[model samples]
Target: MKLKKLSAQCLLALGSLLALGAAQAQERVTAAIPGVVNAGTPIEFIQDGFKGTEGPIAAPDGAVLFTENNNARIIRIAPDNTTSVFLDNTNGANALAYSPEGELVAVQTIEPRVGVILPQGNARTLAVKVDDSLGFGRPNDLVVDKKGFVYFTDSGANGAVKPDPTKTAAPAVYRISPEYVIERIAKDITRPNGITLSPDEKTLYVANTAGEHIYAFDIDAKGKVGPRREFAHLEGLRQTENGPSSGADGLVVDAEGRLYVASNTGIQVFSAKGEPLGTIALPKQPQNLAFGGPGKKYLYVVGRGAVYRIPTLTAGYAGRAK
Candidate 1:
């Protein structure tokens, strides 16, 4: 069943990518913002031609911290459009978000641990090993909420690994509570990648890179996830040989509760009610994104060797999270 669906989507993608390219050239406008936000806002290339960039998150200092996935370095993009390496020798780090204490919380993929970059430029391990019995393979992306609880995805979507039950790891979502307890919040999805909480922090949006769906789950007071429902599917997106083949990679939520998801169709914007609002098309397939810059009105997107900026009317859910 899954293969049949993927085959169909791939066929559609093969036929439509030419049209997609033509459309991108025409608009370069590329993004469709509906339901509330306007779509005419210009999307530009602030920085391009780097190593594989991913996991963009806003820092408290009006700059954006995005990971260079291929090089395992976290680069900071200042408001002035200058880029610098913030942290190096980072074990293939991916996603990053600021904690309540203003520390940079990051997911170090190869080490499979979460670390906090101190204000003085040091890294501290928050959570190591996923569990005693099962562990994380690739700690892909992460999001930190108000009370300092951490939610992240252990997505084994990068390479085709020959499965060894002794070393086999399942892709899932795990949470490190405020009290520093680690627990698996979800394991039903194929490879849980991008994650974000609503402004109210009651709903959690998770993108499955291996599968064609994005799932949303209700968050309890204690921070545990309730039952999940299909939030959205990769309607016009197709698969790739490596990953993100299902379309949804890194996703973010705005203060208006809109979800900005990265896929083969650029960034798909969904309203608070999970309605398909529109797509912010880009020249390259984006790996991750975040809302940063001075007013948090700037959308920073990272992809194969480049970073982009898209100005929007809505702000990010960073300082607005309850």
Candidate 2:
């Protein structure tokens, strides 16, 4: 009788362990955002152990290419989950976008410039210093319009580093014309991080890493942007040891004009009209994200030295490679 009692207790303990494991596995899957993400769809952990992963963009062949900035190399993840080095010695490139001319443009932070880095000899500087004297603080992210204009954000220096006002330009957004003319578009943002344009090219959106809201501007027909306005309030902002920050890092749009923002809370989805849809919480805080895979159905996210993807119900903006 004593042996049977001991056996029953062991079985009960084993069952409890199995149940806890199942619950934890379910927690890995994000909460569905209705039309955006389906319920019970797991946020698949693709790979990890990267150094400063950022600036993910889809290739023409459906592979996702991202910058391992600290490693100074671009890594490509194929559809079959194979990984390969796409480029090296990237000058600390953080964000990437494809020009209308099919060239890869990046915002390099090492030398702090925006330029093309691919096709070997075709590489050339697009914009370096904001002017002859004042250099950019730190070029963080960029996006190219159909007319070949590039819009990027300079996030400025972090708190640890003191920047001289005479040399380092304040945090701002800039536009590089097709003729390679650099224009300062907005300079009032506290810390401009990620940048993107609307699918129709009518609006420009920027994420403020230190602010509580995502900002937007109206784009004119001539590829100029107007006054800045608060588009959507971000979630998961808190008082960190460094100070208060929303942790809004990367921004992207879908085919239907919905905005997907990588924030401290997760991927916060907003409607075209700037209504809050729902947030998809991930296991790790996502610093950047872009749509990739067949038909741009997968949202590839990178942050904190890891990569993750989620099969989404809708697709990314088909007109652009971002």
Candidate 3:
């Protein structure tokens, strides 16, 4: 029945796109430097010599923000190609999203918690524990919609024992409404990790790190997740001198609705129909990416100790916001 429901949902989504027109449904982009993965396209290494980084979120003013997990700091890559610390003394700020009202919402990597930080640098705890009952193992990635609702993933077996195997609740995706109420969306996903929303705010794409797959969820008017569907499957590609297989990690969506996935090989682009489009080679294995700049044509990519940007065909969330 799950398979059938997903088939129906895909058809419905495709039909909705058709109703809108094909020109708006698909977008194509390539690296600015043809094939060389250089920093010419404002590919600035904001800070170097860090353990790792991920979850690049684009703010309103064409600034891109990402988490330096090893250093427990959130850094901003300015539009001028400079870098500065947005938040410090943060505990493993892994994935972050900007609310409709411009608040920075983050999934704490070290602690099993979600926090909301204001532009003035004030941080407030939102949801500390899952369901207000079970202790969280790790709260991984998050994304927010235009309606001020936040959707996040919790992989409950980070270091601790799997939480309740019989229930398949160890790895799950959740949604938090504007009123601050929380609800579990999907609990059976294998290692739900990186997450983002479609440009139309109708679909949710989640990456399962261990499972090596990206899953999709249809979000309804009430913010309810319909069912689980496979968005993309990652096979272990040829390993580079840098690290592991092209295991998929973080995800971001463009104004044209294409999904940009951070993988070991580089950045993988996929259409809304789950078709493999192309790959953007990186100097190093990128951990995450975001679109920024004046027209949202710049792609900001993050690696271990560096960040880079290239020109893309589609504008980013920042440009789209306007």
TM-score of each: 0.84, 0.89, 0.77
91-161 per-residue lDDT for model 2 (tens digits): 88999999988899999887788999987689999988886568877899999988898999999975223
Instruction: Pick the lDDT winner.
Output: 2
Candidate 2 regions exceeding 4 Å error are 1-27, 159-165, 240-243
> Candidate 3 — which residues are off by over 4 angstroms?
1-47, 119-122, 157-169, 235-246, 318-322
- Relative to the true structure, candidate 2 reaches a TM of 0.89
Q: Quick one: best TM-score, which candidate?
A: 2
True-structure Cα RMSD, model 1: 10.8
How far residue 49's Cα lies from its native spot in candidate 2, in Å, is: 0.9
Q: Which window of ten consecutive residues has the lowest lDDT sum in model 2?
A: 157-166
Compose the digit string of candidate 1's lDDT tens values, residues 1-322.
Answer: 9999999999999879987775565345644465434656666766776787888877767788888867878898999879999888777777787788877778876656787866646667878766765546778888888888899988763543223446646878888987778888888878788998888888888998767778999988876679889887675646467544566789888878888888877888888788888878787888888888867888888887878888788778756321
Better of 1 and 2 by lDDT: 2
Candidate 1: which pairs clash?
Answer: 31-280, 50-305
lDDT of each: 0.77, 0.89, 0.72
Pairs in clash, predicted candidate 2: none
Instruction: In model 1, state the lDDT of residue 101.
Output: 80
